[model samples]
Target: MTDASLAARAVALDLVREVLRKSVPLDDAFDAHPDLGALEPRDRGFVRLLVSTVLRRLGQIDALIEGSLAKPGLPKAVVHDVLRLGTAQLVFLGTPAHAAVDTSVELAAARGAAPYKGLINAVLRRLSREGAELAKAQDAGRLNAPDWLWLAWRQAYGTARARGIVEAHLTEAPLDVTVKENPAAWAAPLEATPLPTGTLRRPAGGAITELPGFAEGAWWVQDLAASLPAKLMGDVRGKRVYDLCAAPGGKTAQLCAMGADVVAVDRSARRLERVKENLARLHLTAELLAADVATWDAGAPADAILLDAPCTATGAIRRHPDVQRLKQPDDVAKLARAQGRLLAHAVDLLKPGGTLVYCTCSIQPEEGEAQIDRLITRDDRVERVPVTPDELDGLAELINERGEVRSLPGMLADRGGIDGFFVARLRRLP
Candidate 1:
């Protein structure tokens, strides 16, 4: 193996190990490592691909590695990291079979697993020969999901839909950007179309920041589904709008761009700084507050509020593959409780006849529909103002019976896929 390839493989191992062992996000891990900065741009790109591919297909990779191992109780951390690098090369990358296998063996030997080198070699060789059969027998594509997550999906979406969501996440996500202005001008260079809500959909490749509209802030990266809740607020022109939990403020930016008097509020000082940076780039303005929404009163009730409450973010699995590895079923229950509390608090801050848009990136019913159900049931002042068909022109498929919008990747495959999102708009009684 060449020194460059070896170094890249080592970085891949470190990334995978950190994600698995420490649950650090892949992007954060990459950004924190100075060694990764030394690699050439192409090698850096390769490292990201290798790590992301492994994360997206960890289930299949683990299955293959486990099949090769002799003992059931062998430590998972030792084998899983090595297999992640190997599987990324063999399955996703299409690296030459010999080079992929040999480099991995060298990686194992260098890590002082000299005794396991022959085992690694023999297993990978066998996998190279019959990996397809093993994948078929194990149904690697579907069962690759963690057991808890697989069961939860099965419970939530049923067998067929759960299978579809998992399969779609295996592929890399496309780069979708929300245009601040002049979608047509921006669309020309990106070779993308202005989808509903003025989002530009680009094919998933190339340097993100170097893309034409990115530097000038003509558009900012936001998923088509994620862009919906702010749109559902319906023309905030002169109204004061509070975006609770508005860190890294995509929704807050959208609100301000639409001419709303916006106060972007969140608890994290660090995250709020990101929101400030984004506002500066877009040449937009908002009142930034680093205070907890649950306890911090926003002076007086605003004309509108957008509470993008924190949840499991299951809908974003394709974009952030780390979610599959780090989040568990119990995490959903915990988040749902938090969402319930935040929703109640946000509703209290709503003025009579005002609009409050409640949203979550989670696909879990508890976090999305169920929480809304609980809200309207208890609050006589609140009523569901269903999002009509005309209002959701390009997103008809995602609208539920109750008028809530649920964006699933499967719903928008033709116009370009969108992230999983659930949005509910409610109007306080006059």
Candidate 2:
């Protein structure tokens, strides 16, 4: 193999180690990898595909590795990561057996773990021969997700629905966008299909900025489920709306296009800069603030608040497979407490009789339903607005028993599945 190609593989190995050992998110590690930018574009793309494929199919890959192994545990993290990536290349990515084995051996030697070079070669070669049959024997959905999270989903949704979610995560997400103007007008131009909940879906490939309507800023990328919360506001034109914790601002742009006087607030100034840049691209204007919404005073309550609180974000597991890999039960417990606080503070930031919509890209009920239920129990000053079937274009399956929109990844199985999102709308008492 060429030195550059081998170096690219080294970087991929390091990134996998970064996630498995350090628990750093896969994307964060990939973006922050210092040597990644120096590689050839083809190598860069290879590295990206390698790392994400390893993460996405980690459960199945690990199973294949363990089954090939004489025993259960790997001796070193570098060994584990190297074998995992090699197994991914051989079993799932259709990499040539020789290239996967040779490079994996080289990677282990370069990492100062030369002792296990033979093991990697033996395992990867074995995988090349028997990997396909071994892979077929494993339960992919259960293997890919953390046990605690799988159990949580199974308990929250029944076994059948949970299986659907895990299997959905096995496939990558499609390119979904929120159009600023007449949705139908842009649909044919973009060659996109309009989703039941209103976002447009197209084959997810190529640079988004180079797309047809992009130059004119007619649409911005947003998941179908992520776009749902903003629409729950119901014609925010001319209303004062606050998009709390809004960065990488898809919802903020939606509010601006809806003609709402939008103030998008997030804790990080640097993150908010991206929001400002997006709004400029779309020719949409909004008030951008870098402040913690939990305590930052808006001085006056908002006409409506869209609190997209931080959570475990298991809903976007397909796009961010690291979420299920790196995150744990403690992470969920910690984030749930924070979401609860944000929900209460967001309620306080609303004008009496004003609207507040809370959402999270999380399948966890603690971050979604439980937060609302607690708010309604303790804070009698607010009442459920109960999103109706018509509100979401007659997709009643997306609604929960309490009338909140509990969109699971399993919904829309024929078309690519949507992200798992939980949205609830409420009105403050006068």
Candidate 3:
């Protein structure tokens, strides 16, 4: 095996270990990994694909690996991970059989587990030969997702829709970007298609930094669903808008670009600094505050407020497969409680007659509809401003009966699935 291939596989192995074993988020692990920066960009992408394939289809990979092994279980955690990486390549990623097996064996040896190299080789070779047929018989969607998540999906949406969400998560999401102005102007140059939601969609390939408008800061990478909560604010020109829990600020940029005086608040100073940098690059400005949204005083009420509250982020499964493994059932409740606090605080930050858009990148009801439901029932300070289909670029399908925006990954399967989001627009009582 080539040194580069082994190096890439080694990095993928470590990343998978960090995500599955230690429960670190994949993007965070990839960013923090020192060795990753040393690899060529192609190798870096390869490593990401390997790691993602493993996580996104982890259950099936494990099943195939376990079934291929001569013995019932592997001895160590790292060996399970080693086998996982090899199996992902073989069964899911469609990596060449010889390259997948040889590099994986080398990767195991590189990890000082030379004794298991033979076992890995034998298992992967067997998988390379028979894994596809084995995988076909398996319920891949159910295997890839956690039980709690699947149950939650089933409870919230029905079994069919839950299965749809799982199936969508199995595929990688395409790249979606929000542009500063004139999407039509940039679409051709970037080889992108304009979506109904006013964002540009591109294939998930190439260095994004090398894109036509990226260096010029004409657009920024954002999921179409993520960009929606900010859009729900409805003509923020000269409006005072507060973006609560804003970090790595895409919404802040959107608000600023729409002529709002934006105050972006987050608990993390480090994350706010990154947001400041992104806004600077985009030629936009916002009042950046490093303070807790639950308590930080905005001094004066806002004309519009957006509370993109934190949650399990289970909705982003397609983009960040690690969320499936990293998050726990308890995490949803914890974050839901926090989201409740932020939602209440954000509502208070809005003036009478002002609009408050509450949203989460989570499909969990407690975080989205339940929070809004409780707020309207108990607070009496705000009333739901049911989203008309027209507001969503006429994508009426995304608007729920309650007028909230609920974009499911399964809803747009033909055009490539969109991220799951729960958005509710409300108007504070006078």
Candidate 4:
């Protein structure tokens, strides 16, 4: 391996360590790097791939490294990160066995851990040799998830279902885009398929803006599952729609594209600016408001409201691996509480007999089913409007027993997979 490649790997490893040990987010670390600006494009991509892949399989990687070591007495943080990067290369990335082993040792040496360099070298080489055997022996369930999280998932969704969800996240997610007007005309050159709700599914690649339809503002990238709740609100043409917690506004854009008068509200000015930019590119207009939805008032009730409430976002682990690393078990409950509060506020903003589409990109039942259950029990005016099989035409695999739309990554295996999302549509009685 070249000196520059090893150096970049080291920098990325350091960043991953800070994220794992100190809870710093990956993007923040990337922005703070003093020398990251000097890296070539390929090297930068390598850095991102290494860090993100390691984060995605952190539990398994740590378990493998722990099993390989005789004493397991190394500093928790150091060994945790070293093995994470090394295992990601050897096991997940298909990097040459020698390159994965040697580069990691070189990284250890550069970090002033020359004493343990031999240990790092020997263990990784052994891993490269017996990784498959080691993995087979490891408990697939415990190896892939933190104990509490695994247990929570098991309880929420049976063991088999939880295991399947974790396995699904291991694969790369397809890039999905939302097209304005005709999907066939816009998606043909891109060689993509138009899924339900006019989302274009394509293999992930290149800068989004550099994609064929991007320059023309023909479409904007949005996951197939993430685009559904807004669509479930039915035709919004000429209707007053309130999009709470809206920013980077894919849903808000969807509302405006359907000819709705939308008040897009979000807490962050920076995020709201992104919504404004997206609306401009799509040649759509919506009222953009920067304020916390939990506190902000829409001034008057709307005909329809889309509350894409925030949760732990466990569903998007494939797209944003950092979520798996940064979010803790307790965070789920905290986020559920926030979602409940936001749902209550959003419901209050809906006019009687109006539709309220409550949704979250969360696999945990607490954040989706349980939250909705709470609402149904307490809010007498709200009634469940179960999504029908036809409404999920191309997405039958995502519809659950209770009619909530749950898009698991494994669902659209043939057409191209999607993110895990739970969407429930409801209506307030007059």
Most accurate candidate by lDDT: 2
- The ten-residue window of minimal lDDT in model 1 covers 71-80
Query: By summed lDDT, which 10 consecutive residues of candidate 3 come out lowest?
Result: 408-417
Clashing pairs in 2: none
What is the per-residue lDDT of model 3 for residues 242-270, given as tens digits with 9 covering 90 to 100? 99889879999999999999999999999
Q: Can you give the TM-score per candidate against the true fold? A: 0.95, 0.96, 0.98, 0.93
Q: Give each model's whole-structure lDDT.
A: 0.84, 0.90, 0.89, 0.83
lDDT of candidate model 2 versus the reference: 0.90
Candidate 2 lDDT over residue span 181-225, tens digit each? 888888888889988767889987666777888988889999998
Clashing pairs in 1: none
- Model number with the top TM-score: 3
Model 4, stretches more than 4 Å misplaced?
136-142
Better of 2 and 3 by TM-score: 3
- Looking at model 1, residue 374 earns an lDDT score of 96
Off by over 4 Å in 1: 70-76, 132-140
Off by over 4 Å in 3: none
The candidate with the higher lDDT, 2 or 3, is 2
For 1-430, candidate 4 gives per-residue lDDT tens digits of: 9988787888888889878878887888887888788888778888888888888777778778878888865664565577678888887788898888888887877777767778888778888988867777766545656677678777877877778777777766888888877887877887888777678788875667778868778888889898888878998899999998897699998888888999999898988888888888889999988888997877899999999988888889888778777888789889999999998888889999999998888888889999989999998989999998888666677888888898765566677677889999999999
Error of 3 at 43 (Å): 0.5
User: Could you tell which candidate, 1 or 2, scores higher by TM-score?
Assistant: 2
Question: Model 1: what TM-score?
Answer: 0.95
Provide backbone clash counts, one per model: 0, 0, 0, 0
Error of 2 at 166 (Å): 1.2
